[model samples]
Target: MNTPEPAYTPINCDYYDRLEAWATMRTVCLLKFYDEEGKEHEVSAVIKDLYVLNKAEYLLADNGLVIRLDRLIAVNNIPVPQSC
Candidate 1:
């Protein structure tokens, strides 16, 4: 027996998306915040040196400190950010 997951967990969603050329340079990411309820969240971490391809799944790692993007759901290309 084990505890069930909450209805909603707060995890910051940050990832790159669909791009023909920059596909190999993009990555999916997630971050947990202190304000989050239950003090826990689910999110994928940065991939290793190897470029993360499509259809990768994420697994919890580093004592839950980090989440790895082993599988990807979807990719969307957004404009890169620029400094002021």
Candidate 2:
């Protein structure tokens, strides 16, 4: 089996912090994040819901997509700013 190249490096805390803001404000944008196997994925949708389970935070999109925050690489093509 061929190993997959790392598609996304870990992002900063500011990015994760903004995720809740986006969800709360219902922002629509393309979200880029990595899956458990390190494969990257993107989706164009509005932030519809967010919840935490088992100590992991997840971002739920209006289009029925869910992504874990730690795997996120970028939002709307912008790199995550440094955590404050």
Clashing residue pairs in candidate 1 are 17-76, 18-75, 18-76, 45-67, 55-72, 56-70, 56-71, 56-72, 57-70, 57-71
RMSD values for the candidates in order, in angstroms, are 10.6, 4.7
Query: Per-model C-alpha lDDT, please?
Result: 0.32, 0.73
Q: Please tell me which predicted candidate would have the highest lDDT against the true structure.
A: 2
Model 2 alpha-carbon drift over 4 Å, by segment = 1-13, 81-84
Task: Put down candidate 2 lDDT per residue, 1-84, tens digits, no spaces.
Answer: 868543333336666667778878888878887777879888889988777766666778898888866676778897655334
User: What TM-score would each prediction reach against the true structure?
Assistant: 0.21, 0.70
- lDDT score for residue 84 of model 2: 40
lDDT of 1: 0.32
Q: Alpha carbon lDDT of residue 45, candidate 1? A: 44
Per-residue lDDT for 6-62 in model 1, tens only?
233211233322222232443454333222123434444443332322333233332
